[model samples]
Target chain A: MIELKNVTKQYPGQPHPAVDSLTLTVPEGEICVLVGPSGCGKSTTLRMINRMIEPSAGSITINGQSVMNNDPDHLRMGIGYVIQQIGLLPHRTIAENIAIVPRLYKWPKEKIVRRVDELLVMMGLDPEKTRSKYPSQLSGGQMQRVGVARAMAVDPPIMLMDEPFGAVDPIARTHLQDEFLRLQKEIRKTIVFVTHDINEAIKMGDKIAIFGEGKLVQFGTPEEVLTNPANEFVENFIGYDRIVKKLFLYQVQEAYRPAVCRLRPEEIGNALSKMLAEKAEVAFVLNEADKPCGYLTREELEQEETARDADGLQKLAARRSKAFVQTTTPLPDALSVMLEYDAEYVGVLKNGLLEGVMSFKDIRRHVYRREGE
Target chain B: MKMSWERFQIALFEKAPEAVLTHLLIVVITVALAILISVPLGVLLTRPRYRKFGVVALNILNILNAIPGMAVIALALPILGLGIKPAVVALLFQSLLPIVRNTIAGLLEVSADVKEAAAGMGMNQRQILLEVEMPLAMPIILSGIRTSTVYVVSVGTLAALIGAGGLGNMIIGGLALFMPEYLIVGAGLGAIMSIFFDRALSYLEYKITPPGVRAN
Candidate 1:
């Protein structure tokens, strides 16, 4: 556990402290994301944990031991740090970059080599291909991965990431975030993540600590911060779209309702009866493997001029656009696919098998229930 | 007085090799001493505590550099009194500026981000200098050494005025006797030495540069 009690950082000449007397505790194996607008002291708080920026007042302790007690170099070596500008040494090859902390610890040569390769693989890079390559040779996304790999070299118990994904393009940022979330499940280091984007905070943070003008305004789980913002600043910071952003926290499975009318492509004759029985405006079609291939609207089925396949069954329109989400996909992402395909509901799949559907109505119902609560 | 091939052969064969060796000695000793003094001074001046002194020290070096080589040798003659040692001391003064300036420039040119990363990785100040700063700054620093070396070789010919007995002795002897052969041998060898050292150090500079940094 990392705890800061009444910690403050005041620059020598500046009137306002960069970080005011603030207290926060991050429990073991949890990610505490520090978030705010620019110059709000989120980065200052992170640097203080590693003593890169010393706190002017109060104490910072990790696992009940004061951060100030140890030699600063020794203290920093035991903690992992990553930054917005992925700082890999230009002089070192990828393997050497990852080996820095381990070499500092004087690990055996064989052990260091093994650890370097292990980290590269863990970070999804091919060791043989990337080990000899220099930082300049790697793309931005690759360099960021190597930066994280280097930080994790010694398996430090605490890692501080200051907008680790902020430098990547949006598509790569999403991939990295998801990859890290998966990696965190197994590593479970106490982490203090800093980010400006609320959606990122909600997605990656086990708990979000909101800062404003060097003061920590609120610290709670994403659910708490979104549902019950502390004040006007938080409400505005969380934005008018807080209701929709909250959906990112929930998986498609949570809001899933079994699709009322499901038909195999060969079972198209029963589509009208199935929709009538369940009062569904649309009927989902599944293939022999039970994967959702398409859907049929009641208007299309009711039309006499509707096209049919060679088997005398009504043709499935919008066939196999992959308009489905895995059961584990976030509701916001699932909602995006719904919007993209212009559909009322998105089919939820488990291992390529159709499980159910989550509709716009289900999301609205979920939001209404939370708003009432 | 005629430019005779026989006299040229005599000058080249009889006196050329010894004068060339002595000239080489003056330049090599002067450049070596300059490097030893300048590199450490440069590193020290760049350190936070001593950084304020850097501007003062560099200005002094720049003034020393501005003094002509013959005048520096002439000034050294009174204090050290006529020898290869006095000549080397004079040339050493002339050589210090380039190495010192380049070393300071090289160390400063190491990007702030790279140094921050080094410190963030828990490298102490010493390690950052040895592991990161030095390697990255190497090519620039070596080019300074090259510049200093070539300047020293060209200037060592003036050492003969103080009886230092380098190729300058040959040139002075040829001037008094009006022999074109002696002048050609002395000046030619000096020019060739300057070119050799320049090319050699350039290769060294290229070789020592870290491969990743070479991409830039």
Candidate 2:
């Protein structure tokens, strides 16, 4: 665990301390998000942990050892740090940028190359295509991915990200956030994420630490902060859309009702019986690989034309299932897909197979009930 | 007395060779000295501790740069007396401005975001400067070096006034005796030398620039 005890940072010639006796603990493998408006000292607190900004008073310890005890550079190397600017070295190619820390630690050449390509692949970048390209050649999203890959080069247990997704457009930002959350599931690094966006905090943070005017207003799980805000400042900071924001806290996996039956395209007769027997409006169509290709509604199946050709059902379902989301996707994302397709229910997939479906009605009940609590 | 092809050929092949060699030597030494002194000084001035002094240093270089070359050569004669050494010293002063100014500007021009990322990634100050800052600043720095080299070659002709015995010697002699052949020979070789250095360094600058930076 990383713990800060009464940590304070006071700058000279400044009337108020940047951080005032702030104390918090980030349990191992949890993402603790520090969020507040500009100049609130959330970024200051993060810098202190890495010794980028030293505390004027109090102590910071990682697993019981004071950060002051170790060499600053040595301490930093073991902690991964990413910034909003996506600071990949412009002069270095993607491979060399990722290899920086490994080379510094004196890892063997072959091992570093292997690790570089492995990281590129892990970031969902084509290793062969992206490895030799420079930062300028890649798009903003790709550069951000490379930045994260560079930080994780040493596989540091703790990653510090300062608005890491803040620079990209909203669409790319969401994609990056989802990809990172999925990666975190496997790595489970203790992460301190700083941002000004409440929805991002809710989506990415395991524990949200809210700050106001250089003081931490509240620190708890996203649900706790949303339900039981410590004071007026936090309540206002979370804004008037707290109900909609709460949708971000729950995943599709949690809120989705499991599908009653999923049938292959060739199972026309079976699909008809399943829809009628369950009295469901829609039934998901799965391909040979068991992946949801699309859905056939009761109206469409009843038309008789769609069911006549077994091969025609496959051709009809070729729209690529726009109204589908992975099980880990946040409810708000699922809602977006539903709205985008103008559908009431969104298909939730687990490992590309149809696991269930979540409807707009389901999210209302889930979020409203949680809001009441 | 008259403009003769035979006299021009003699100036080109026989007397011109020694003057060209001397001119090349003075330009080479002066440019080398300017680079050696200016590059490190420029880097030092850009350091956080020394950044405050950067303006003062640049202003001083700017002042030295404003001085006329011949006047500088003449001013050097009173202090160090007349010779190739004094000529070189004067040319060296004239050359320092471009290199030092460009080095500082180039290093400063490196993106702050890139530097912050380097530090955040655990690179020490030295590593950041050598690995990140220098390579990025190289194209600008080389352009500065290129400017200084060409400037030094053109100005080395003035060193002949201090008895440096360069292409300037031939030009001065031709001017006094009114020999157009000597004038053309000296001026042509000097212009050729300047253009050659400029083109060669431009090529080097292009070759060394990172592809990412080049794209920009």
Candidate 3:
């Protein structure tokens, strides 16, 4: 959805252009990352997308329209922008921070509130718990999440995040990346992310753009770039231990869940019988959103079958995390996600529909493929 | 020559106090005015369009600072005349060099990561200046202020020669009087004022400069 044609950026008195004559295209709904050492102009290229820095030469188009003629204010509104410092306007509250772009675009108050609430839930944050806090009051992770929330606030089709998680500590950074990857699956915005850290670029990006000395070294999917680099710079840029890096992408992110024959608030007896007949260990108790509010394990069902008040059974319906993902996410990211929440799996929400499993079998296939490749 | 206790106390209070107070006022005003002009000027000097002129302006200010205070007063007498105005002008001239020079250095030294973050937000030059650069520059610039204030306070006594009536007047008067006490009072007060400005500015230095910006 975003395309660059022969872009070049030359700072005055500099020996060479910061972004050399370049042409590239970032496909719709993909996470494209630009990465290089300092002064290589990976950042310049990313900035050029939003016109944060005007290209010295060539053309850039978003959604098939050239950015040169496009009004920057309007163009920026259509593309989300994030920064390393999590620039949430320290003066503003979290809710206000998330509401900035929408307010700028004249989105109605009701719509803004609705969008905020929805994002807060999807990002796994309690809006009531954290929405009123300022950026300074938040933990580094919380502030980073708020930054993403603010970027996603307007539901822009394209997002430009320049090392968005760079300022946070490593543990927080990993968690933020996982949460963002999950969020991206649901929102599907075309994103151009920038970072100097190669591991981060490989971990979070669908495709990676490598740079050296203000020139494009290579642009390709992680596997292609790792396996067959475009040039010597690209190969060196990928660095050694690349095979180890490639193996991280094989995550057991998706899985087919047990058929969820759930019980209504009133039908405890029937639900218990179904659980016993199926020899099921657990089953979901869904709420209005068709989301699991809680789970009923076999032990609880058995106890209810003996001498239980329906009320007691409902009490035992604990919010256990049985909801899990489909096989879309690469294994390493999926493993990272599982590691994040201390969960074995996460429910992959895509296209507003539940997809089947991402399990060890899927990851094993990739690992086995690695042995051959 | 044994000194009486009562006589010494009276001498200390009467002769020493005026010089100290006058010295304090001269130094304070000079440094304050220097900060007022230089901080803003220094900030302006570092802008991209003005950067090339930075070396030029800095050289001129350094030369101005190098001139002796008495020479500055002598030069100013025709244009500014004999008064506290010349004292202030001299102190102001001495005070500005460090404030501007340090400000430019401090502002330019901000990390590229932080600068890039500011630029990515779609904030224009003014926003970056006030919000990002200035706040970060406060500490280093304050050090310059501290250095200049100490220097300005030391030179403030020079105002006495031009009849500007600072602590310098007491020393100069004491010198003429051949009353050693008067000389002690003037010289002692100048030293005290210098120490005070240095300590106060250092305290402010701690408060304004964020941790990790510099070494202690």
Q: What is the TM-score of each candidate against the true structure?
A: 0.95, 0.87, 0.64
The predicted structure with the larger DockQ, 2 or 3, is 2
User: How displaced is residue A252 in candidate 3, in Å?
Assistant: 5.8
Candidates' DockQ values?
0.72, 0.63, 0.13
Tell me the spans in candidate 1 whose CA falls farther than 4 Å from its real position: A264-267, A278-282, A297-313, A316-321
How many backbone clashes does every candidate have?
0, 0, 17
lDDT preference between candidates 1 and 3, better one? 1
Candidate 3 residue B199 C-alpha distance from true site, Å: 4.7
Which docking class does model 1 fall in?
A: medium
User: Across residues A72-124, which tens digit of lDDT does each residue of candidate 3 receive?
Assistant: 65666677888887766554567876876777677899999888888777767
Deviation of model 3 at A193, angstroms: 1.8
Best by TM-score: 1
lDDT of 1 by residue, B1-216 (tens): 689998899889989999998998888888889989999998998899999999999999999999999899999988999899999999999899999999999999988877877788899999999998888888998999999999888888889999999889888999989998999998888888899999999989888988998955
Model 1 error, position A214 (Å): 1.3
Query: What does the lDDT read for residue B21 in candidate 1?
Result: 89
How would you encode candidate 2's per-residue C-alpha lDDT over A65-119 as one tens digit per residue? 9999999888999999999997788889999999998988999999999999999
Higher-scoring candidate on TM-score, 1 or 2: 1
- Candidate 2 wrongly placed segments (more than 4 Å): A252-330, A333-365
DockQ of 3: 0.13
Pick by TM-score: 2 or 3, better one: 2
